[model samples]
Target: MKQTIIITDCPEQQGWQKNRELCMDVTTYLRSDSRMKAGKSYQGVLRRDVTCDEMHYNEQMVFIETSNQKRMKRNPRIFEGEHITITRRDDGSYHPNFRPIHLGPDFNVDHYATEVANELLWGLEGLVDNA
Candidate 1:
């Protein structure tokens, strides 16, 4: 069984380091669920690049790179091995204008996304309290 998970309609890609913070936050849960000491699979969703007709991932895809592919113009961090990758694929399961991608099986994308959203959103309750 392939371990994969996806969360559509994720939080906005804004704010100072918000995306990175959130990813790091989610990475915690992943560290606990994976059967492997470390994950070996990469996952993410595919969406059209707003700047062009080309396709790109909505989020950074996780990957474990061991060799330096300098010719490919990959990020320097990924060459460190076991790190999130900034990669986009040309093929995937297409539906309408988006493609669903999973970040391996270490974490449940659907469940964790909901859990994280709820956890974060709960703080907003005070702002809505009788406002």
Candidate 2:
């Protein structure tokens, strides 16, 4: 299995560069768990123009292993592209779609990112336990 942390903004490089710290943390978090067979290394892809404009839209998606003949219904839905994006903003800072920064819409970039990571890891945990 492969895991990635992609961060994007207007300029692909800027977005990818900015969130490396968070990515490192997430990488460490994932590797520390027993289920991470790949160890601490990760491959990432960042982009400018992306498929989803809103980053917070997909909290987390988990998918079953393709090799499995029968897929079991799991808690976390897995898929691909564990990405984070800054879609809406003002004063040049990323803002959560649910959170407007001032009014506190709902989830900010950091919070939203954390939420996504948690969901993904939680799903992986389910896989490990079931296995």
Candidate 3:
């Protein structure tokens, strides 16, 4: 299945000190047949207006695949009009073309998606029926 997700903001690019992972403000529903409501915890390829040459190196500045305490260096730039086209697999895993950034351990997709949905659905308690 193919789904388009709208990205509004990235806290890490906005100078969020405690934030490390690259989380986006999604404004699309994942499972519902609704547009511009709230996105689900789905991961996919995000196409941005900017490009990043991110690389991970070790203490000796040598490129390594996996490292316990890896050091990463990259030219991080954020631009407007960033969105993603997520591709779903048979195993129900969303794989994006871009690599996942892990600077810290504070970014959670489910938590962020829930927060966005709650914010957008706020003040509409009467409009939506729980039952």
* Candidate with the greatest lDDT versus the true structure: 2
Candidate 1 lDDT over residue span 91-123, tens digit each = 422112112345786867777657545533443
Q: Candidate 2: which stretches are off by over 4 Å?
A: 1-106
Worst 10 residues of 1 by lDDT: 77-86
TM-score of 2: 0.22
Candidate 2 lDDT, 11-124, residue by residue in tens:
566644333222121212232344545554422332232134555432222222223235533322232323422232334332222223342667487876686676556545
Off by over 4 Å in 3: 1-104, 123-131
Model 3 misses residue 94 by how many Å? Answer: 31
Q: Residue 62 deviation, candidate 3, in Å?
A: 67
The lDDT for every candidate, in the order shown, is 0.35, 0.39, 0.37
Residue-level lDDT of model 3, residues 45-82, one tens digit each, is: 33323334567421211111222243432322221111
The TM-score ranking, best first, is 2, 1, 3
Evaluated against the true structure, the overall lDDT of model 1 is 0.35
Query: What are the per-model C-alpha RMSD values against the true structure?
Result: 26.0, 24.8, 24.7
Best by TM-score: 2
